[model samples]
Target: MIKEFREALKRFLVEICEFVQERDISFPQRPSGKYQVEVRDGIPSIQPIGIKPKPDLRALDTLMVGLRAWEKETFGNIMEIITRSERLSQAFLTSATGDLISGNRTMVFPKIRPIIEAYFAETNSFDFQQETFNRICDKVEEELRRLPYCSKILQCPVVGIHVSPNCSDCCLQLESDLQVRSLSLEEIEEFLEYPPFLPSFFTTVVEMKKDMEIFKQQLCFPEKDKKRIECVVIALRLLFGDRIFVPFQIERGQGILGKVLLGEQQSYSLEQRVVPPPRLLHIVDQEKYTELKELYHCISETLLERDRAKIAFSDNRSKQRVELALRKWSEGLDQVSAEWKLIAHWIALEGLFSPSSRQELSFRLALRGAIFMEEKEVYQKLKMSYEMRSRIVHGDYSPDDPQLTEIALTTEEILRRILRKILQQPRNYMPDQLEEKLLETLTK
Candidate 1:
């Protein structure tokens, strides 16, 4: 494999040099008197006497085509090994070499011009070229063999929560790679800035004069360790109520600021705009933080257990039901409208109860949920919210209706409580078993 790789590298170097030399020869040189003033019908206009020709990249295109063919045939295994190395991956990302090899020709010529020049500077000797190619191959092999001890830091801003000054150093280690901790003021300021641009004269600097104003607390994890962290965020929402959320933007959707400034009904395409950063509204003490960590652990463990069961029993209905409920729960929290949020939560409840038929689904959901939570009053709340859900779905309810807020809140609370109880004891609360348990409760 090493011998083959070295031979391939030498051939690539030779072709790259030839391509660069051809490009240099064909590249256009500046012409004197390139522009001239011409008069047409008593009107004077500036016109170009000689137009600058665009660079012909046919040689580069051919080189890349051949390189891609070589990569497809003989470079797959070596690339896999290189990309898998954390140190190598970081190096590639920083150096833009990854972009270069992936057929991004924009920066390829500039990047390799110096190296090609150095190779040419030598006395037209094959030995020097071979030595340089050997060094390149050896460096790549050394990097691949070296043990990766470097770790990647991924920090996500936590909205609506602050770490208490008393526990500034308290890092909630939720998993081997995931944790919640407070960052320094400097670090928090990094996220608060607007995306870079040339500012207009109208742009004014507004200072945040208050102490500890910005959200400094963040969910930190190692690279690729963010799996199921969204579920953990859902768990936190359940624990802390709806006072918090991590804000996210849809790439293909209209910017929120654009919609607000322009009327909501007005359609426009504005991909970039400054928006308010999500704020920290609540302070979390050590005790509450501990509870949050425990809840996160419980939810994460339940998900892992369900995943394992899903693999073992391919047709595991219980696993499917639980996952569906969790997804709906997460979706509900993501909604911007109160009506949609209520409907999403209700759908999650339906997923949990799995009513035998659509007939009397409200009653069944209420009964099953109330029974699961050992709270009789929960049934009345569930029934009323389900009725409101029906009204909203049928277009009978107005968006301006004052009761929508209260009902949405009530429905979300009920769903959160039911989900919490189910996640707390996953084994005993399987959908089928929970129905049987509710029947047993009714008999008693």
Candidate 2:
């Protein structure tokens, strides 16, 4: 690659020399003689008596000055070419060499060094600038092999390119390079001022964090109540399947910012951990599970607690619906009196617990088919949920304890998971009844 650049440089300089010599050859000086002056109308002109000076050669001094200027210009052009070629060659060379070389030694074209040496020997007065250019190109190419575009540029066909290389850097060659084009300095400033131009990975992390915030806010109180937090995690196991602390750890505090998961603590970026699944909350593959787990932890930690008692709950219709639904299962339990938050949490638990009896199984299947799916992640969540159900059903748990001062706090944990799943997915959890209502509204 260096050889090609050096060859190009040599060709350009030689061409410039040819142009200079052709325009600056000495001509026979015109015989020193006086010229006859003639008057025509109001103008007077002088005519040469002997052979006139050759137009091409008469301006030798000016041509010599221009030739020198062009020599410098040609050298500058070489520097520019060499600099650009070196930049691209680095990209190409890195890609071509892979990780085989220790460093950038991948770009050193040892094959072309001899050719350069021969060129200098033949042209006794070689351009010192060219030699320096060659050394830098060779050294950089050999040294910085790991640079993103180094391997890419080295492989690009410079000669065949139709346009000027100065125009723009192609993304293919940039290798994750991001450039913001703006017409004016103000526009550039605006782009730079925009805080969102973090790395693509960072942008994704921010989004995941936002979702987790909303989930936490939703989980803070009963489902009927809404919290101010922005994001919520829908499914915990959907996020952290099997292991608890492998991908991320939960961070909790007083404020919204405090609840945020410190994704930087992980070895991989959030992007690596939480790649959005093809379907929300559908934990079919590993990526889906990873995304869900990260979300769950974040939501759980950030979830706020409601300050006031259950008075500011959702409307009576929702309350009545809850009462009717749970009346058959738990006779004494007032699903209606239960705070909307608690009711939503309980509904989520019922959905996740996978009721054992045939009648209960039918309800579980109905809920699963309705809002959730029967995936591995969901099954694992069901297992976790049943542990809570065991404490609530088997043990002497209280329903009227307002503060949930009962046998255990499994309800809260199960509620958190269910809420996270809800936050992770709202549309899926949208009741079939609600879908019908929406369709009815649309038709109306």
Candidate 3:
């Protein structure tokens, strides 16, 4: 009976993190009252309920009285309890051996008497234990009742880590929808001082509180990273809770097919590159039109080679190359300054010759670009592109920089050349090795 009491007392105290030696205290098998932390209909409640009381034992009745008094004073400090209850439990433990064993030295182990005489110096001291406890419970219930029911979950599959090109190498673009509960970009930076699972050394240049189509960024993950994908999904669910609805479009031709929810919780269709709907060619100038016609076929044949790869790894490898090629191809269409386009072009070209310095990377890509195009002018444009790139980086961009258009076209021409080479070559798409072989062949 004593051992059972000790275990129950130990569980109760440790659950509240107020640990004490259970062996030093004794509990009644039939507790008179209970203070319970109960959950009803998804809401938490700390309720006090009366329990069956044991009869015919005066010492157990004393223990019950002490427990009820302790519950009444629980409104005070979490650590502080009814002082008498502690003394009662201790006294009950000692009563088992009686007062005769105080001076006897046992053969197996020495039984030492407790040094402290009493847990509370004055039991006669009076305090308002019950009244204060009732007030606290009332106030707690009132506040909890006023809170909004959390029936819906609010979660944001927050895309926090954005790695763009070197122009913004150390810079990060914080993206999320602006909402009342959205964690600020600055708050995220402080949180990353001890990141849960991502790198944290990047500098903040511009913070976007909530502007980007945030859900689109999640499409970057593929099936190979399903575990990592789940981790991110779980993290978002935790940070924002269940009301998270990520609505994004899966491109199909020029029109919307319908809407679908995107998350780990539901089944999602794989994103496929769509074929553009048929349209008539309208070229004002017939000369450039024919040139573009041939260029389309050349790129198409290259794409065919890219599509033939059956392996998952190679498919991803080629997908990245094609995406880079398309991005570099489209920069000429962006409504930005020539210097901005130059910067964008240089970044796209980094895949071919990835070195630290922009100048070296530009030169090497230009060398390969020139070799592929069989045009000496591209090499000169490559050199000039680097000089202009530097001016833009240092905030010394000149609007009237000579030959800006020529340089932009030459940059586009080089990206085209790189893509064509990848598709035409029998040897698989290997940019890193291609850079080495090209450098060795050109220099020697």
Q: Which candidate gets the maximum lDDT versus the true structure?
A: 1
* lDDT, candidate 1, 1-444, per-residue tens: 566544543444455445334333222123332323233443323233465223233433432232334332223222222223344223222321233233332232333222232322222244533554355445444433332222223344555566666764645555565666665666455434422322121111111111110011112232223444554566667776653544331111112111111111211122243323323355667887777776766666455553322122223565567667776776676676789989888888887886667777788888778877888898898888889999989999899888888988788777877776665666667554656886786799
Q: Which ranking of candidates, highest lDDT first?
A: 1, 3, 2
What global local distance difference test value does model 2 have?
Answer: 0.31
* C-alpha TM-scores of all predictions: 0.55, 0.20, 0.30
Clashing pairs in 1: 160-281
Relative to the true structure, how large is the alpha-carbon lDDT of every model?
0.50, 0.31, 0.36
Location of the lowest summed lDDT over 10 successive residues in candidate 1 = 206-215
RMSD of each: 16.1, 24.0, 22.9
Clashes per prediction?
1, 39, 7
lDDT of 1: 0.50
The global Cα lDDT (0 to 1) of model 3 is: 0.36
Mark the regions of model 2 whose C-alpha exceeds 4 Å error after superposition.
Answer: 1-238, 241-409, 420-444
65 Cα displacement, candidate 2 (Å): 22
